[model samples]
Target: MTTVSVNLPATHYDVLIDRGLLDSVGSLVAKQWSPRKIALVSDDNVAPLYQERVAASLAAAGFDVHRYVFPAGEASKSLTVLAELVRQMAADTFNRDDSVIALGGGVTGDLAGLLAATYMRGLHFIQIPTSLLSQVDSSVGGKTAVDLDNIKNIIGAFYEPDLVIVDPNTLGTMTQRDLVEGYGEIVKTAALEGGEFWQLIETIDSPAELISNAPELSARSIHYKASVVMADETESGTRQLLNFGHTIGHAVEALANGALRHGEAVSIGTVAIMRVFEDAGLAEKGITSKLRDRFAAVGLPVTDPLLNSPQVLDKVKNDKKNRHGHLNLVYLTAIGHPEIKSIPSSEIASFLNLSVTN
Candidate 1:
């Protein structure tokens, strides 16, 4: 078992990672606060697997619990679904004293967290992220949002959770593709941290092996994120480092129109941006080659077959990270070190063209 604490200016929370932490969620929530009602928000795919277990645990702990399940996938993370969740809570007379428990992947966590943050003027939020992607990244951070008009996370809030319980056992249900997609985020994190972490990741061959080594690797990733979030809670400064490949990644994701998974698109974006870094003389030679090999070994796609460079550029121009039409991109001079640079949106198209040609 490993515990990572996130200390912020407004509040502090602990992320507990272990093999069977889900069994102890009742006690964990009881220790925090006593609520009149609790809402368990999950997606349709995950509800059949773990929802009953989580709800049973919470119910046994002497709490009134209600379950709200939505259709699974990124498409569910929208205003219509969010509004429906809010309506359900209102119909149940749920007040601010109630709490919301997110029990699925990144999509569940994002939607439920937003529900908790806005319902009845804000309710307590707890995260029990089941997917590797959510457990390692989105579950810890306070960033919550749903896609607006196919633009990812354009509307959201910075509402922290009361506690995060990560049970590796839940990952046993994930498909190989889901697990591999998650490794993209793990590799991105390793690239940002560099040094021994990067070296360790370079040797990883499979997601199962990575999960077997989760205690050390997960802790390292979580601690790095905690440190960054602690330094810059609202993304005003240093926290931008976390968006290492997201500027390009999010654009590619939006362009895929739901065909590409978030991590998959990010994998392609990571390679594309690193190529740009190399061409600009900001990165060492052969860096892209090394990363491409590593990404391929882990079963991630290094390039987008359906990639349309012009459309990708258009999507990036509308990215939330852009400030008044200028893009602030996070680039790496080396593994584990990242810097933010501002470039004209027009220039990004040319840079990506160069990347695609090379």
Candidate 2:
């Protein structure tokens, strides 16, 4: 088992990663906080696979486990679903002494964590992220939210989990597209952490090879994320570096209307931003091409033909990263180094138009 500790001013927690860690989650949770009632939240897609095993484990550990399963997908992360969960917890007479366990992908973690953070003035929260995206990123960070008004994660809070158990074996059931989506985030993390890490990623040519090295890759990505979150827990400073591909990524994702996966959209967003930087002489020559080639090699999309530049620009106008109508974009002078620059929203729109034309 590989264990990484995230030490923060408010609380410190451990992220345990290994195959079959799911079966031992109950003992792990018991060590931290002995809850009389535990709410295990999962989605329909994931429930059939491991819900019983998780519930049985916790039941054996002497906790009253209540299973709450929602429909799978990003659509499930909403105010309505959150309200239902809150009502259910209330009906069960759950108190602050109870806990909530998120046992699925990013959506499950976000929704369940948000529920735990807000319910009963904040109950204990635990994460058992089953997806690669959640395992390496969302599962570690305290950022939790749900989609509202067609905007992604516009309504959310910073609520850390008491413990995070990541089992790589959960990823074996992921589809090819899901795995590719995860690689998009992994590639983005490697670019941010550059040097040896980037070199190591460059050597991995295929999705199969990447999955084969999931344990090392996930730990490295989580370590970088944990270090950044520790320095800036609230995303007021260095943590913004992690938004390398998300500014435009989120916008395009909304425009696609569920056609684009988060990681796939981010892959295209990374390439799009690099192209804009290259045009303005802000990034090194051939850097965009190199990134495009790398994304392609990993079966990630570098550009979406269905995306319209103007429509995407309209969506970016509402992105959370914008401050006072100015776009704050994270750009790379090269891999491993990211810079946040403020540009007029109009200028960003023009750049998106130019990227489409070129």
Candidate 3:
């Protein structure tokens, strides 16, 4: 078992990682929270696979478990869905003493976390992140939100979980495409850290190898993210480094319109922005090539047709990171060295090498 502690100014939580950690979630959560009614929030896709096992574990720990399943997808992360879930919880007569457990991937975590944060002003929240994307990234961070319109994470809050339980075994059920999606985030994270970790990622040659090493890789990501969160919990400054590929990535994701997964879009976005860095001479010449090679090694796509779509430019205008007419983007001077640069909205096309009129 590997544990990463996110010691922040506001609160602290432990991200526990291992194979079969799901079986121990009830006991693990019991350490921090007392026995109470648990609203086990999950998606339709994830509910059948492991929800029964999870519910049994919670029952064994003497907690009343209530299952709430929703349609599984990015679309579920919205105010309308959030409101409906909240209304259900209210109908269930839930209150502060009860708890919320997120039992699936990123969408489940975001929805459940926000539900825990806002329900009756706040309820105990625990995360049992099933997907690799959630286990390694979204589950640990205090950021929780549902998408508003096309904007990602637009309506959310900084709500830390009381505990986070990660079971790499849960990833075994994922499709190859899902595995690649998770690796996309891992690649983005390793690119920012840029050293032995990056070298290790480069050494990984296949999806099987990635799954074999999921626990160690996830621990590294959690530790790295914890350090950043400790430094700037509210994303005031340094935490922006974590948004390494997200600037262009989010725009690509919005434009792809469900054709691409979030991590896949991020993989493409990272490649796209690295091209900008290379062209502007902000990064080494071969950096983009190296990144592309690594992504291809693990079946992650490095390019998407929508990456060059003019609609992407329009989407960038709605990005949450924009200040006035300038967008704050993470620029990689080299692997492991990241800097935040502000580009005027008009110049974004030039930054992306887009020929569209601004």
RMSD of 2: 1.4
**Candidate 1 off by > 4 Å:** none
Candidate 2, 22-61: lDDT as tens digits: 8897788889886589999999999999999999989888
Candidate 1 lDDT by residue in tens digits, 1-358: 7889999989999998889888888888888878459999999999999999988888888889899999999999999999999999899999877889999999999999999888877999999999888888889879999988777888899999999998888878989888778778888888888988889888888767867876666677888899999999999889988888787788778878888888898788889888888888988888888777777887888888545457777777777788776888887888777888888887877666746435
lDDT of 1: 0.85
Instruction: Name the runs in model 3 displaced over 4 angstroms.
Output: 355-358
Collision pairs in model 2: none
In order, candidate lDDTs are 0.85, 0.87, 0.87
Residue 92, candidate 1: alpha-carbon lDDT: 91
Q: Give model 2's clash tally.
A: 0
